[model samples]
Target: MTRIHCLVAAVLMSLSLNLQAEGADLYPLSSPAEQERFQALTEELRCPKCQNQNIADSDAPIAKDMREEVHRMLQQGASNEQVVDALVARFGEFVRYKPQLEPRTVLLWATPVIVVIVGLLVITLVVVRSRRNTETSSALTPEQRRRAEQILKDAEAP
Candidate 1:
């Protein structure tokens, strides 16, 4: 039983070591500060190829390039803002996870609001026109009223 316990402990230790080794090769950032900055910046940036995912979370070639660029910028003593600005300059605002609020982006942001307002106005106009038509056509001609009364009397007789 003691031998079996030792074997189990050795297997657990090996598994832990293997898992650590797998991650060790992945984070190429030289220092903890650099790694943190790289992660923050990448997570904030969009991956162009995988538009739904941030750079750090994507496995695309562009994401890898972006990660490498982050490392390079960190080595050059560039601040997070500076790195992000550089990326925005090179890749445009579309590369950012959060698009900047600007005149260029006003249409993208305002289109839905404008459409909703127009839809409401259209519905209001339709309802108003229908209501007005109903009111205006409420009164029947004398001949039409007489015909309606005759039809109702026939229906009741049956």
Candidate 2:
């Protein structure tokens, strides 16, 4: 039982060490500022393969390559904007988590508001039409009212 416990402990320790080594290889920033920049940049950049996930949280190969490229650029004394611009130039605006508000993206930003306004307008028209129909239906013509009264009297006589 003691030997089994020792073996289990040794295995857990080795696994922990291997995990640490793997994590260490992922971030090779030399300074605190470089690390901070790396974290910020990774979070700001979206993974192309994983459309919803940032590069830092994605396990895709493209994300891994982007992380390596960011580290390399930072190591070579690149500014945050410089690294971001390089990536943007290579991958286009889709890779950016926060797209810039320019002419091209104006439609993208305005689409939700436009949809809401159109929906409200449709609802207003529907409600107005429904109210008008109810009002028109309730207002019977003189001939129609007389016919209705005669029908009611005949039914009562029977």
Per-candidate TM-scores read 0.73, 0.81
Give one digit per residue, the lDDT tens place, for model 2 in 18-91: 99788766787787777888989999999999968999989999999999999899999999899999999998
Candidate 1 residue pairs in backbone clash: none
Query: Which residues of candidate 1, in runs, are more than 4 Å off?
Result: 1-34
| Every candidate's lDDT | 0.86, 0.91
* The best candidate in terms of lDDT: 2
Q: lDDT, candidate 2, residue 15?
A: 100
Give per-residue CA lDDT, model 1, range 34-138, as digits (tens): 778877888899888895899877889988888788778888889998999998898788788777779999998898999999999999999999999999899
In candidate 2, stretches whose alpha carbon ends up further than 4 angstroms from where it belongs are 1-17
Clashes of each: 0, 0
> What is the Cα-based lDDT of residue 2 in candidate 1?
100
Q: What is candidate 2's local distance difference test score?
A: 0.91
